[model samples]
Target chain A: MTNIEINTYLTFGYLLWIIAYLVAFVAFRDRARSGAIFRAALIVLLCIHTGSIVLRWVESYQMGIGHAPLSNLYESLVFFSWSVALALIVVWRRFGTDLVALLGVPIVFLILASTFLIDPNIRPLIPALQSNWLVAHVFTCFLGYAGFAVSFVAALLLLVARSSAKAAELLPGKKLLDEIVYRSILIGFPLLTLGIITGAAWAEHAWGTYWSWDPKETWSLVTWLVYAGFLHARLSRGWSGGRTALLSVVGFCAVMFTYFGVNYLPGLHSYF
Target chain B: MKKSKTMETGSSESVSILFQIKAFFTSVRTTVFLLFTIALGAILGTVVPQGEPLEHIAMSGNTFLYRLALILDINNIFRSWWFTSLLGLLTLNILGCLFQRVPSIWQDLRGRNPKTSFKLHFRSSLTIAQLKDRLVPVGQEIMRAAPVISGTRDTQHYSWVKGRIYLIGFPLIHIGIIVILLGSVIGAFWGYKGHMMIAEGDSSNKFALIPSGEARTLPFTITVDGFKLVKYPTGEPKEFRSNVRLTQDGKDMLTGSILVNHPLTYEGISLFQADYKVLGVKDVKLSFKTKEGEDLVKVADPRHDIDIPGTDVKLKTLSLDPGTIAQGPGIQVSVPGKSDKPQLVSIYQKDKRPLNIDGVEIRFLGFTPLYATGLQIGYDPGVRIVWLGCTMLVLGFILTLFTNLQKLSIELGGSSKGTDVAISGRSRKLRKEFRQKVEGAFAGITELRRET
Candidate 1:
């Protein structure tokens, strides 16, 4: 299929994902399990989403410009949702089949929403991003970001789970939500570490200087520190569950700044 | 002895009260909470403008708020003193928090084991069968030996908890915070950032000095060999690369392409491609009128004073201001010892007419471009320390996320609960997780996690 057609399909999948999740959220009040058709459709949508990413890769290759589809804001959002999908599947394995669907709507809709906000044109990377590390560096960072997005969504649910008595009553306890959140962070933090390192290493290769305190660089480190604090509080201070949710929420806010604030900041990393 | 004791006792009460107050700020929660506030403030600073002059802020639909934001330095938030102080306070709070927690975290890092049964570890009710099954997996994850007893049924569930590396996550993250703070702090005081533009053939040592504009300058010297702006077929700029020879004290430090988004650094001096501009140069022919004959001196220089030989009048090029498509570049020329009015004037371009003078006529010459370059120059002596701390910080996070202290014991012997069931025990920060894993293994098991 053509690139536009593939994107259309992906958009349709996102719509389905939203529907699945909205219904799942409503059903969560009744402690209802997902129907077979709903489960099958959600799985199909997830598969289609994954296929779209791979299709984007193929499209890039077709243009004779072989690069990862993660060089821009649009591509990153698409990849972010992909990461969330993979992570939610992992959460589903642990939490049960239905609870996983609860997170799908936000992840999918957020990705869908980003397509409208970011410029959709596929531009070639400047010589600076022509390095081999561009793909590795950005992928790891966004994957980690995507994982954090999952944790952020889970944290939001935890906030709901904390207040919505029936939701918590039927679902796994605050402890399980905490576990899922921690696991997401646990998975995401290291990837973020790798992302930052890879980005720095790429910077060293491209720009001779490893760290420039470029706004994006600074904010990424700041976000990492915030999440680092979260992991620290949860682990060392013997805090878990509720507190972990709050930390992830804060960290994701930092991630938002890292994504959007750099352009507005006066510092060096404003190049978007 | 009684008088001396009374004299000493008089100040003890005040000393104890002072110590109590001093201890409050030094408390772990207080220090951490304070650091949290600083972090929050730093986030706010990024949102708010930091270092900007009042009159300079562009009035984008609102003249009042933009003017106020400029006064607050909200645009340059990172460099502002208030923001810097917030960073400094954050650094101190993190250090204080780390100092308070490091000893215990260090002990945990040294691989201490918890010598306790799962029942005791729970601090809640636990069955003997539940304790044994948790031992094997938890032992493998933490790489610590399971605390299962070798005794038949007479074991007393002895346990001594140890998990200091688990504590290192906090200190490691604290060190990361300190590194980031150090980078920003040192960068705040020592870092110098500004931009200078160099045309196709430009070289200057004083590029370090901020040019006569409302912009900052660099410290080291930079010579631009040639600026190459590679563009796509559609004319969109693909990349702007500059081959620059960076020097400090006449010694060539480094030379490479400083492209867009790629900064070249040498001896801690970073040259970034902030932007580029074109400077247009024009040529004009000068004629000095004499009684015997005319002396025609061709000049391209825009200097205000050019010596007119054999004549008292000095031919000067006052200014070259490009007017319009029909007019092109204008050159106003005047001779010293002459009137304030231009003795000779020329609007130079092949497309436009030239200016005539008294007893001589000046012809308009062609034009050439001089490109202006902008570079952000920053030199932080503490970047290495900050970078080292950043590396360790990333490493510590990786360890914490991937590794943990886990303890599980599976007793294969006769039941300790007076039943003939195999007893299993488990312990982990992921209480629910360990419960689920253990529960899945045991038939009809209803496991629950109780945090201590």
Candidate 2:
């Protein structure tokens, strides 16, 4: 299959996610069986999404440029959305809560929609990217980003659940939500640290310097520091409730900027 | 009496001042503040173009901002005094915090219960306890259900703790950061980076350093045997490789290839394939016809003067342009006696052009191209230490985050109501989950009692 065909499948999955989200929201409001149906549909869409990614990988091989679909902007974003979906599925299975999907699905859909604006052609890898480290580095980084996305949704849920009694009844307790946010961050922080370390090793191999103060590297450091601050504040200062939730939101915004905003700036990592 | 009171007050004031300094360095607030400030500084460094010379910035019509950047050293913020000072302060703060907390963390690791005072208050269902036949069996049951670190039994008290080992991770992580800072300082003081460009079939032992713009000679020479550039069907670059041989004292030490994401290292220095370029024409073959109608052939270097066959008006080649889409190789030639100014003549690979120079017909034949490879060389002694620090940092984070430091105490004592059993615990992380586990263990004991 060609990349265009794989993109079509991804578009279908995106649409399915939107529908599942709406159904899940309605179920959350009315306390009906639609939540289960929404979950089943999400599982099915995730399968299709995985298939499309595999197909893209195969297409790259057929074209004589065999590499994983984690190279450039379009591919990374697609994989990012897939990672988010996978994290959401894991959270749902562990907690048996579909409230997270209400916020997660739309974010995934928006990311997939943004892919249409970017170039999705399967281009040949440049010499700088021809390494085994690229796959490990980008995959771990996006997974970390996915974990932060889930935490962001959990934090947003805490805020919403606190404002309305009706919403609070449908959602998990405030303390539970706070713990979820903390756990998601706990999962992400190490992964991000690993990603940065691997990126530095890769840079050393390519550029003869580990850290050049490049825009992308500096911004990733900023994101790490923000989350580091969040963890320190919560652990030592006993920050919780609204303060922790607000920090989570801010940290995710930094993640978004690290992923997207740095592309507009002039840097050595522009190829991503 | 008045003199004694004044001296006492003076000593008290000094003591309080010393205490305030210690507090400033040890507080978590200082850590938070330092992190945010460094992050902000980093963001500003990325937003502004770094490492640009002040003159360049001034020439860009931002003289005022250029002067400000010069004063603040914002042009190279990472190496600026303020940024370095911030890092130094952060390192000091981490040290102070570790000094203040390590003793307590060490005590916790030694299995000393810091919170010896216990209140007989039970509220959550998870903390509620049921009377058991003995305390040891209850502690054993809990240990069998989950991993337990330590168990203590007294006349009427028993307690079990788990995950106390993770308390050491906090101090280990701080020490790892300190190691990393030391590594960076060593690199800043002793390490050096330089760039070198060598043509095909050439050798070089010297390169220009980046910060000082001074040339440094190495102990070994690197020879570029060949350089290859592979392009895709779309004319985009796919790969670049430089086949090189390193020689020292006229003996070949190492021979290998270097490409992007791959570097060749000899001793402590490394050479990376960074860039390439085509320099100029190597040699050009020309065919000429004399005034007697006899054809003659000759070779000429683009940079040097060449005597055209059977010509007194000495001909010289000034330059050659390797062709592009807009034009072909246009050779510039000058005849000292025929004309004072040089003339341009176009040459192509497939077609031959005859030109009249000093009344002699000259035909351009063919030429060869010369290329060069750019390599970045570096020598660093602290990279290994930095890598070690990174590994410890990751390990420390995993230990501190995944392992939840928890303490559980099962105190059995008699009360006014009955033989009161109180089960209470504390956790640094996953408190709710730990509470549920405690509740599950209690439920198991309650079920056994009913069976009896």
lDDT of 1 by residue, A121-158 (tens): 66666666676666788788887887787788778778
Candidate 1's C-alpha runs over 4 A off are A17-44, A64-66, A113-118, A127-137, A161-172, A189-272, B1-28, B54-82, B106-170, B209-223, B246-255, B261-263, B280-376, B407-452
* Model 2 TM-score, 2 decimals: 0.84
> On residues B29-118, what C-alpha lDDT tens digit does candidate 1 reach at each position?
554465466566566655555444545567355677586465645665556556666666656656665666666556555534333233
* Model 2: fraction of native contacts: 0.83
Residue B295's C-alpha lDDT in candidate 2?
86
Model 1 alpha-carbon miss at residue B433, Å: 4.9
Task: Assess the local accuracy of residue B85 in candidate 2 as a C-alpha lDDT between 0 and 100.
Answer: 94
- Quote the lDDT for A249 in model 2: 96
Q: What is the TM-score of chain B alone in each candidate?
A: 0.58, 0.75
Instruction: In angstroms, give how far residue A22 of model 1 lies from its true place.
Output: 6.5
| TM-score, cand. 1 | 0.67
Q: Which stretches of candidate 2 lie over 4 Å from their true place?
A: A27-32, A162-172, B55-67, B114-142, B145-161, B281-369, B406-426, B447-452
